[model samples]
Target: MKKTLIIAIVGILTFSCSKKEAEKNTEKTDSTNTVDSINTARTKINDSIKALNSKNRFRDFSGSHQFVYQNDSSPKYSGSINFTKIDGERDNYTLSGNIKSGKNSVTLKGFAQVVSAKHINFTGEITQSIVDNDNGKPYTRKGTKTFMSKDDGKTYRLQDMVNGSGFVDYIDIHF
Candidate 1:
């Protein structure tokens, strides 16, 4: 009877240990899987960037667009602006453009960010110090822009305007 009791206690302890070991293994496997998924996502983003680089699609881009600024009391003002994409870094790009406003030409310097293959955001600080060619009034604007692409990375469509109390500027690009 003493031997039998000892055996039963040992059996219970062994069973409990086995279950704990199994639980530990399960947790380890889950952690590994999460790491693998993160790596896979990083690889996919890298592959897309490589594809864009192979095509030279992002190098030296130029386009023309019409910009309209919305105001509270009056109809919006519309004018044309041109953009030139300068190549330096993937995260940031330079832009040079002229925006027409009330017979004035506003010079623009823009820096753009590519958050991912599907998202593009840009912010530009404009010098309103330009002498108005017609009205002789100085103009200034400061704004940020966001654009999204449904495609992998081929084209970027404007999303919204934020951080500026000036105008609703629309840019039309051909690429």
Candidate 2:
């Protein structure tokens, strides 16, 4: 009877140890799978953010849009802005736009340097041609100003930074 009881206790201990080992291996596999999934998720999220930044940073300002000046809407000055990518760093761009209202017209040529996500420094010229010689004041070329996007990134608005802004409040380039 003593031998039988010893054998029974040893059998129970061996079965208990085997069961515990199996549970430990299962836990290890589960933890490894969880870690792998987390890493994959992180990589995908990083790729998405990079794509969005590239899209918003560089844009094609195509399609016709009205250039509103000093709340004037009698006859629309319609034009489109074009971007020629500069050869240097990614932040530099050659900006050009043209608009016309009857015989009067305007042309904008500038270098747009990105200052931040919300601002750009435009240093260039706006030349107004009055073919009919209208008596209205010319846009007197406020050559340098910071362009800000008023409607998110759809329209970039620039205004003269000084007083007596030549009857021009701002110009919206639907970039």
Give TM-scores for every candidate, taking all chains together and pairing residue i with residue i.
Answer: 0.37, 0.52
Q: Judging by TM-score against the true structure, name the best candidate.
A: 2
Task: Please report, in order, the local distance difference test score of every candidate based on alpha carbons.
Answer: 0.56, 0.65
The candidate that achieves the highest lDDT relative to the unseen native structure: 2
Writing each residue's lDDT as its tens digit, candidate 1 over 1-175 gives 9999999999999999999999999999999999999999999999888766544334444466554343243344444555555453455566555556554444556876666666657788654322312233554445786667666545555555321434443332223
Residue pairs in candidate 2 whose N, alpha carbon or C atoms collide under 3 angstroms: none
What's the lDDT for candidate 2? 0.65
- The list of candidate 2 runs beyond 4 A from truth reads 1-70, 129-137, 161-165
Candidate 1 Cα lDDT to native: 0.56
Q: lDDT (0-100) at residue 150 of candidate 1?
A: 67
- Candidate 2: tens digits of C-alpha lDDT, residues 65-140: 4454323423455666666656534566787878777766667788877766557778898766543324444654
lDDT for residue 151 in candidate 2, whole number 0-100: 68
